[model samples]
Target: MEILSFVAAIAVGFVILSWSADRLIEVASTLASRLGMSILTIGMTIVAFGTSAPELLVSSVAALDGSAGIAIGNALGSNIINIGLVLALCGVIYPLVVSRRIITRELPLLGLVVAFSLALMLDGDLSQTDGFILAGALVAYCYYLARHSGGDSEDDEEVVILSISTARAVVESLVLLALLMGSSKLLVWGASELARSFGISEVIIGLTVIAFGTSLPEMAAALASARKGLFDLVMATVIGSNIFNLLGVLAFPGILSGGLKIDSLVIQRDGLAMAGLTAALAIIVVSSLSMGNTDKASGSTLSLRRAACSYIPRYKSAILLACFAGYMTILGISALA
Candidate 1:
């Protein structure tokens, strides 16, 4: 009966999650197009952060509720899922053709964050010092990305401005963003309550259930773009979300929490899982190139067949799922023991 209840909750949650995610992407993309913003910027500021908002909101609420473990776990688990499951699935669906810029910039920063996160967790808790350090890195990273974004071309920025006036664009963007935010809140509420009504642990619920819940927009957006042959948009949505997870999802909760705390075991396990997955992603990128598969070597430039071979060893998602399984196994065993 308990298992049945959990399954039922998950089914409903998945439906709501998918519906909400579609709405989010629809509104965000429409607004971005209306406001003269690029899809990349939309993915970075609006869509990316919007999708991650659930994790941020849940973590903040968990921290305030004094369930710091849930807060920390949600943040860490979501990050792992964001990079591993989300990116891996995106790649599998349509190989993530790297931009030379992404190869030298975004990938390296991701690796650094993975390393830095592990170093911070070398201590039992993520103290204020750690929080500030992480936050500072985030700011620096954003600054770098802004400078190197290679955006703001005369034609790119100018094209949108001519289509819509600034005042109208601002109003439309705000209204759309508000609707997106409100729906997301409803989705999160439905998810948490449904999870509790079942017998699922909040951590597991957060890792698998809610993580996938929030990622729905990216999944849908990417697939739609893939079908439409808008491959750059797909890559932007996938890679841009990764950047947002680190900057917004991970950073927001720590600042709001006053301090972030995790069990040493949680830190070690989740940290290793994230790092291992990130390393696998890098290997997939490099190896795809070495094998004369330039499709994934740069953005939207690879052939379909080569792009398919881009994610060899596919250990990012597999390892994360395995580690999650192992973590849950230990949890279940410990509880039963």
Candidate 2:
């Protein structure tokens, strides 16, 4: 097939994948609720994981297909995009702010998950043992979140409860699951083909094309939340997606492939970059607008109209974007090598 044909397949795959993941998550959450799970629990666990369904499904397929580099890269690359792309872009277009609640909760949990996952992979092997540990961590993290979230979320954050019959919901969920699987397979095939046709490594393809593609939903969600200054939703959307990426998406390669051997550059370069960026996000999450601010906008030029610590300032947003650009450059150089 021509390159454009491959690109078209990937584009269609991402659209279908996003739609299927959303419907499936809603149906799954409803089923969970029927099984006695709380709304807060559903929001924290199902919704968060569902948002990352693209990455998780993609990685799982890559692992199963023996394309472990793409699996690993999707996991790490998506996390980088979440912080450096999605979060930064949101801050740039809106009066973004950091929430104290995020600083105390989701942010730290994300940091812990990233740190643990990196430590396990430092040996350059994504082994089943590593997968087990990460999976256990994910389970423990979910338990913590579910227990702490209480019975309901009374905050400004809204959880939509769908009114639907269980039998119909189950049927709809099964259909969405099939679509999700098919789309993921299509995306993986297109991405692998594109990588081979262009002489690009799977890791680079996974990091740039597939990573950004998987993160599109996140960028949309974060920007929407930032537009309204909804701190909890913004943080939850990004942080929650990221946490699951590390634990769930990354773990798939290890478990499914029975311990795949990864590229050294993954640990030496991409892995460290991911770790550093997470640390940067944690630091930025606690900072307020008092640190620095640009002058107000004039003559239709854009500038910060609000300076709030509980909100991110323009300069910090710029920093995050810079980090993203620098990392992309690194990926470019590595691909050429």
Candidate 3:
């Protein structure tokens, strides 16, 4: 009976998490647009913010509770799951299309960020210095994006129009942010209790269950956007969510705990899998760009950039899902061992 209560808490937490995350994305995007930001980049910004909200809160809470495994696992595991499982499953259903901007711009940025994260963790210690570095990088990256990403509209669209009032958006953002934080705490507590009860290592529980739970928002957003023929949104959201996962979500343990010794398997098996999958995705995106049916749009590089686009076919989706299956098999075997 007591165990069932933990499970019930997790279930309830997930429900609130999904709803609150979705609302937060909407309000935040509206607020950004109201603040004169371009609509082109708002989806990536707010959707990632909304999806990563749970991971940030849950990991911070886990770290404060002295669960280092859950903290790191939730961050790296979500990156693996975001690419391998959630995005792969969506692509399998309806192959996603992305712009050349993603190929040349976003993909490289992601690689740079992932490499930085792994470099900091290579010594098996996530130091306070490393945490501060990542947080600072996140701020710098956002500023870069704000200045460069959609600057083509620098002339006419200086003041973007949004329907919502600034005051209302602020209130809604606060309320949704609070709900997301509360649900995250509930979910983490329940997951920790179950991990102890089942005699499962916190690392395994964090990798398998809690990672998937926090990723629920991403999965939901991807599927909905895919159904609406918004394949670009689907792809961008995945990349953005994973980026924030590494930066904001992963920083919690190092920041709050001052420093924590990384588990062996975390830096060995799981971290390797994450880095490999990330590299594979980048290769796939670039290859797709190279093969895209593009004609020269103009003499200018910027002209050609805006004109290039491609889609992930069902075959590519199948390949990604196969990789995902292989990864899960490894995790399952490790758990049993």
Predictions in order: lDDT: 0.57, 0.72, 0.74
TM-score of each: 0.72, 0.77, 0.82
Candidate 3 Cα deviation (angstroms), residue 85: 1.5
For model 2, residues 9-58, the per-residue Cα lDDT tens digits are 88998788767656655575566556555443444565456568889988
Minimum summed lDDT over a 10-residue window in model 2 is located at 294-303
Question: Residue by residue across 172-249, what tens digits does model 3's lDDT show?
Answer: 877876776677668767776776676777788888778887887777666756665545557777888888999888
lDDT of 2: 0.72
Ranking by lDDT: 3, 2, 1
| lDDT by residue (tens digit), candidate 1, 242-288 | 55665556665666677776677676666676677677667666665
State, as a TM-score between 0 and 1, how close model 3 is to the true structure: 0.82
In candidate 3, where is summed lDDT lowest over 10 consecutive residues?
151-160
Residue 70 in candidate 3 has what lDDT? 85
Clashes of 3: 0
Task: Name the lDDT of candidate 1.
Answer: 0.57
